[model samples]
Target: FDLWADAPEEATGHQPQHLPAPKLALPGHEESYNPPDEYLPDEKERKTFERTEPSERKQHWLPEKFAALRHVPAYEHFVRERFERCLDLYLAPRARKNRINIDPDSLVPQLPDPKDLEPYPTRTAVVYRGHTSRIRSFALDPTGQWMASGSDDKTARLWEVATGRCLAVWQLDDVVEHVAWNPSRDLSLLSAAAGHKVFLINPKQLWDTERQLNTQNLLSTGFAQAAAIASDEIMACRWDKPSGEQSSQGILAVLVHQRDVKQIAWHRKGDYFATIQPEEADAPVLIHQLAKQQTQRPFRRTKGVIQRVSFHPTKPLFFVATQRYVRIYNLQKQALVKALQSNVKWISSLDVHPQGDNLLVGSYDKRVCWFDLDLSTRPYRTLRYHRQAVRGVAYHQRYPLFASCGDDGSVHVFHGMVYNDLLQNPLIVPLQILRGHKIEESLGVLACQFHPSQPWLVSAGADATLRLWC
Candidate 1:
């Protein structure tokens, strides 16, 4: 009796199964041949192959000699074995974890042409929880009512963005690295964990969402190797329509070895998605966005993946940040529009001002950096309020205000989103600091997001606490 299966498997002919290829190392970091560093003393990590003589390398005879061999079953088997290993890797993982649960209601609606985000800081809300432990990731629902979270606490929690109430607590019992809210159904969520399995959870459960996890009664199986590439991120999984279903349930995991996808972003509207996969050295950051379904596009490198992906509130421009640098890409043109920098430690998240020309970027080392999209000579103002890493940031939609939270376990509420060229207008003035508990937890703020129609905010932290501020 599989606890996660919806129906009795033997009755339905479904069998329990395992991931097709968790056997592979890191989600995307295995090589055809991995030799020990000691095997190559210089540590150059290079491989050498003898150049074969043309006479020896060339086949003694032409295709006519092999024609007779092609008809034999043995010849066919030999050809199949050549690429079997590569194909097996992708197929193995699917068999292990192929129970994809999708709610029929989770369908993309006909969309209006995208519009520019109106400028005007509208409302400001703050969230904080004074609990121990640190938060690792945050996810937002486009409508803003629900926020799904993953943390070092080995659990995934859901909260109402309007009021930070822990709507649901999913005890994963594994280090949940990423929690992605199904954009279509805020209650429908997906989380990737350390166990190498992607768990689909329903904030609304019981009857329909009861489909269990059974691989022996497998639906489909394929291998998905996990390799520890510097920027390969199995945790940063994405769902794309790709000419099929509009539901966020449809996904196509890109095959990128030796990289971790630290940051991910979806387009304002469409089946397009992008992830920042970085490799050691100067490996190009892969930017994958929607290019209409069926158009198999190549990778769009954004210089480096040290930074992350932040979509424009209403525009097509994308803002990616680093420890001390930022780059803006004109999505329509697929070109680099701006290169800006701030000698900051690490800008973890970027939230563009909903109404004004200002931008708020949170960092691990404290101060939240501020900048103007048009005037990119340098950061316009530095909001030096938080004393610890500020992992979550949100901009008000109508009022001239914004909010930030961090490991300090306090949500700093600021009243100004400055973009004045005269330097007369300050970016954000401290309006208030909201703390959920009198005691500060060891973990600071993990993630924060606001609902589209409410004057409130939702947040999660490593303390496994979720709070809503208004």
Candidate 2:
């Protein structure tokens, strides 16, 4: 009865009181379920697990709860090993992190560097001394081994380019105004303009002394065999004359104007040539085809006093230079394609680049302008280094070089690069100034040309000498 009475206090529906919910263990309570040192993870393992675990999971489990879980000795080692694996995955070195090496000097050899160009015509290697009168025109043979020059001496002379030795000379009836070597590698022919007639000279016949002597004897003996042989050797004695002219004289071709033909440019294929007359403002520019020996007027009438004409290196186009402007005509379309504007009052000469995308123009204002046909009708660069008017300009086919001669008695060499991309600007570097020919009175260097394949140049001047610069 008494025991039941003592438990009477719990007889109520509620259980005994929880001792005020067992107040939280005091900071230094020893009997309050303390974890063993080995059972709890070390400071290093705890920090690693904190760093490697996701942020949301870290907020869900308190640091005390993690410590309580690691309180199990077996579980503490497993937790530490998991943290170590995560560290190795993120902090370890990778194979793809290797460094790379590069070299800067590996550029294509075909492309020329502007810094390597030397712009001085310092070497006067040889002086060709055959022409007695002022040499007006000069041309390099296809092989680049020989040069042909025409002068006021009424003769066209061929000389060895390397030695300046005169190989042969052909006497003409009038002053040799212009000369051009056949561009064909298979043919050794030359064309010379004098007075109203053009002569097609065969170098083979001129080189054969026996043939010349026999021809002379036959002419003297009045034999038909000699005349037939002379006719065959000379090819066509005279170029086809205009329809109005009746006589078939012993001449290769006839100029539209009775005055001297100032300039002649051969087509790239050596099939035709163009001629211009300085005095004939009313006459049209004449184009003579070799196969037909016929002349056709490309321009029905002259635009202005035509100074020079040049055929495009690879296109069906020709350029005409007048006193004030340069015009490009399309041969196939038979129309004016472009008219290049110029600030200079007079344009003396122009030469087209082999790429057929640019032109080099020389003018009387002492300016040498480089015109980019694809960019605009205006000169891309106007260089005024020459003291006097520029007389002639020539471009090298295989090299990124060009030459200009002027009345100041100087020849300037420049490196011009026409890049493949339209966005890239052309590189023009003035490399050298060649000065050897003396300026006689007002006349200076009349013409200049580059050897086809060699690093040689030939300049004709009023001094009656053709100087070779290498």
Candidate 3:
């Protein structure tokens, strides 16, 4: 109502408002048929017009003189002049805009120096050499005491992380594709993916009697129910107990898949684990529950070739990485949460940060992409320091560090500090490149992971060795 501004209209006189130039204006002497000599451009002025950019030029056309109106040449830019005139009449006048004089370097976020973020993996500390063939994958136990490695030599070996001593070896009939230690320290169990089957092994010799017994009961509790169910009921996988030599090798139960199992990812709780069979079109991914001995097909129909799978660190989210995209699914709601665009040709591996707010993706195109989950689906940073295909990537569980390894036989370590403030972005700094393994058959480092609790990294390579960097 009038009460709002009636007093201000008189007390504060109406502020003067600047109006734009009128759209219609009379042509000046430059457009006259018989213009003055001062209005015409000289030879030097014509040359300057030719050298200047079209957008920066003061006049669209040069002025010329004529003795008589009838003798004047037809306006060469007549059509262009008409079009510009029409545009001015129809469009609103634009205000003059001044460019921001910002320094390119000043726009960049300030990050701490790499030297200040010390204790990252710097030099090779130990090399565990026992695998006869290239190591496909390896994982460290939650306690950081032991390491399990799978290789093409059809063997899975356990090694003491500190001493690099091979404690035990379990021989298989085919190449071991992947291996992972159960996240739960009480279970002390290891899962290894081989040709068409995933073996659950509990090396009782390395664990105490109570832990061994607990693992056995958990694995064997569902045996009766699994046997009662028909094979047709669970078309994805079958849980069966190994016998004789395989049983003596500490193989608890073998999960038979329709095709070769390429990757295995254990849930944070250790009872449920997911396996990937790239060649299996119908059921490429299967989630298995240890206590119930149940295998579930997460997707009825799959998209691109499944490269790898990872479980969220603290949530009921599942991360499935295809050739070019990483999709996160909500297990409880059975809905898609987000599809992270890696923008890489072929994703080789994936790892979620321990905090579960960030993702790291390695690609065969020699690129490493980092994604902040809270930010957007696109990668926050894309790094291209690898000379060859990036085979593996990992984040330190305790330290603010991440590393990527490739066929160049070098591991590039980076200091990735994620700030607690949501407004503040992550600071990434290149720390060091640890190179020791010799390139063999064009394949260098196959996999890399950090110690669970320490500032150490263990890398498995095609050189048939695992190097420790601290």
Candidate 4:
């Protein structure tokens, strides 16, 4: 897949020249230890001049002849300053709410989650305050009401969709790397990470393995890596797609190298699953599609190891956020789609909206982004909420809201809309900042979520704490 860069248009106005510039000066100041024609000291020169001044030395006034040099560079800095300030003064008033203020609270909003306290945004409440193994990650359902979290403790927990109260716990033998919920199923969840296996659990059917099996495999499984029960069809992954003559229970696992599986996730709504095999770079990792009946094609192997996959909630689109880039794909058409170049070194997290209009991704940059699907130019808004990598992101539909939690011990609530024509502000406007526990006092927030039908939110983290908000 290739990146889509903005097409260059014709020049806007007359071209400027590249001749050697004549030094800037006023009419009277011609030669001698002359002030720059621009006269004002640029920021750099002014800083140098100030840094050289002796603190203890007192300045003696020079005779009128030398008075010109006395003004010095800092004085020059005061004159020119930044040209943008003048442009700001001229432009701010004429701009719309999006341009006038970045934080949506300063101007207008289409829908604001009332739970968000504005101004200090007030950190008035403390939710679940305990957990161990450093809450490495967390996730909210596509519907936004329920929450799930994974920790280095080697376990994943399911919480009351609204209360942040632990409803049940599923244990993994290995340190959990990622967890996900099927966008179509509210009561079901999946946990997957580096152990070379995936788990599926249903709050209602946790005890009903056979009954759960009866549910549509799609109802049972999502694309694969973090295998959830998919639609009722026969679901299995075998390095070898079973031959028609051979009678084998639909294989349950895909064969890979001895131990190369790293991270994998399901498509938001489709049958396609994306995986990141354990190769560093330039190695080919397989990404395959499993069909319903026995056309029996071998699993497809493509170039490049898959790093991570995220699907559009309601569209036929899915994205692969990998070591090289973030690629959009049309699984049905089996064709490459849009690809976006991310400023972050490596993308650790990816989330899509129910409408497939916007995407949120977290990377090594310690920032979160809101990207408009229609506009491939760049991120509409970037959030500087964490000091380290952002491990997870979830956007609440029906409201201008989304939440992200990271290693920095904070969960940021973003409130803003995507602009199609002009990006005037950070699409993500931080509304509430939720802090995880200090290593000393309590626990941190590993993940956070919005309620599906109510105005509630929940979070989980390393402190072994789970918190709920309303």
* Candidate topping TM-score: 3
lDDT of each: 0.53, 0.73, 0.90, 0.54
Scanning candidate 4 in windows of ten residues, the lowest lDDT window is: 57-66
Off by over 4 Å in 3: 1-109, 228-233
lDDT of 3: 0.90
The stretch of ten residues in a row with the least summed lDDT in candidate 3 is 224-233
Each candidate structure's TM-score, on Cα atoms with residue i matched to residue i, is 0.53, 0.66, 0.78, 0.58
TM-score of model 1 vs. true structure = 0.53
Write one digit per residue (lDDT tens) for candidate 2, span 1-470. 67655565556547743332223335332222344445445689667767775644432221232245445343334576568667766676444334666455554235455457753345898988978889989888788877889999898888888888887777777888888876866555577888767666546533546633442332234322222333322332233332322122212233334456777788878768877766754453677666545556566577677888988887898898888789998999988999999778888888899899999988988998899999999989999999998989999887888989998899999888789999987888777888999989798999999888876778999999999888
Judge candidate 2 against the unseen true structure and give its global Cα lDDT, from 0 to 1.
Answer: 0.73
lDDT of 1 by residue, 1-470 (tens): 58786876566676554443444334221211333333322313211112445345322211211234344333333555447657877454453335889877677543222122223223335453432345566676655655667766666666655555666665554565555543433123333332333443434521224221221111112222122222333323332212232113322222332344454455544234444545533333434322211222223343444656667757778777766777777778977878888768777778777743677788888878777756664787787778878877887665555778887878876666454455555544456677662224556666766545564656666565666666
Off by over 4 Å in 1: 1-134, 160-174, 182-259, 279-305, 417-427, 437-442
State candidate 4's TM-score: 0.58
- Give the per-residue Cα lDDT of candidate 1 at 140: 67
RMSD, every candidate, angstroms = 33.7, 22.6, 9.1, 15.6
